[model samples]
Target: KYQRAATCLTKDREALLAFYDFPADHWDHLRTSNPIESVFVTVRHRTVRTKGALSQKTARLMVYKLVQAAAKGWRRLKGANQLPMVTEGVKFTDGVIDAKNRAA
Candidate 1:
């Protein structure tokens, strides 16, 4: 079992390693499939309350507007200020940029 587990981990090493590529402050966001799913619960409930009487296009548009409105109330990501550095190919290790990779 240990040998099999080790083999699987080695084969999937790159994906496993990707988790550490983000800054530690954003790990809570990256680690989940959808961190904002909870926020969508309200949108979903509102849609369901419409009892499917609305046309498909209307329902979609309503949901889209709901999401857009909700977005205005959302908080910014942790360490979002560092996103530009990350986007510029900065290297992070354990969530912070490696000292060697930082600009002088």
Candidate 2:
């Protein structure tokens, strides 16, 4: 009965598990929905309420201001310090860098 669902997950196992290659502190950030999506949600709500009345330039400015406002309340990444290591190609296994597979 669940064969299709099981097969789909099996097929994408590697891709789904790819997040394990990041530092443990960053795992939470990677697992959550895109941060930008939250900011856009506010813009979407406002624009929908206003219908099509906004001019193109006004819409652009509103979106920019909305995003700017949203950013003020945004939380910092959990492991901002680890970003440098990740960008440097350091490999992690189950969150922490595996001594055996350290980046050359």
Best by lDDT: 2
Q: Residues 1-104, candidate 2, lDDT per residue (tens digit)?
A: 99999999999999999988888898778777868689879889988888855588988888889899889998898888888888988888999888865644
Stretches off by above 4 angstroms in model 2 are: 1-10, 100-104
Q: Compared to the true structure, candidate 2 yields what TM-score?
A: 0.77
Q: How close is candidate 1 to the true structure, as a TM-score?
A: 0.76
Best by TM-score: 2
Model 2 score (lDDT): 0.85
Q: lDDT per residue, candidate 1, 1-104, as tens digits?
A: 59999999999999999989888988877777563885588688888888874588898888888898888877678888888888987889988889998764
Model 1, residue 12: C-alpha shift (Å): 1.1
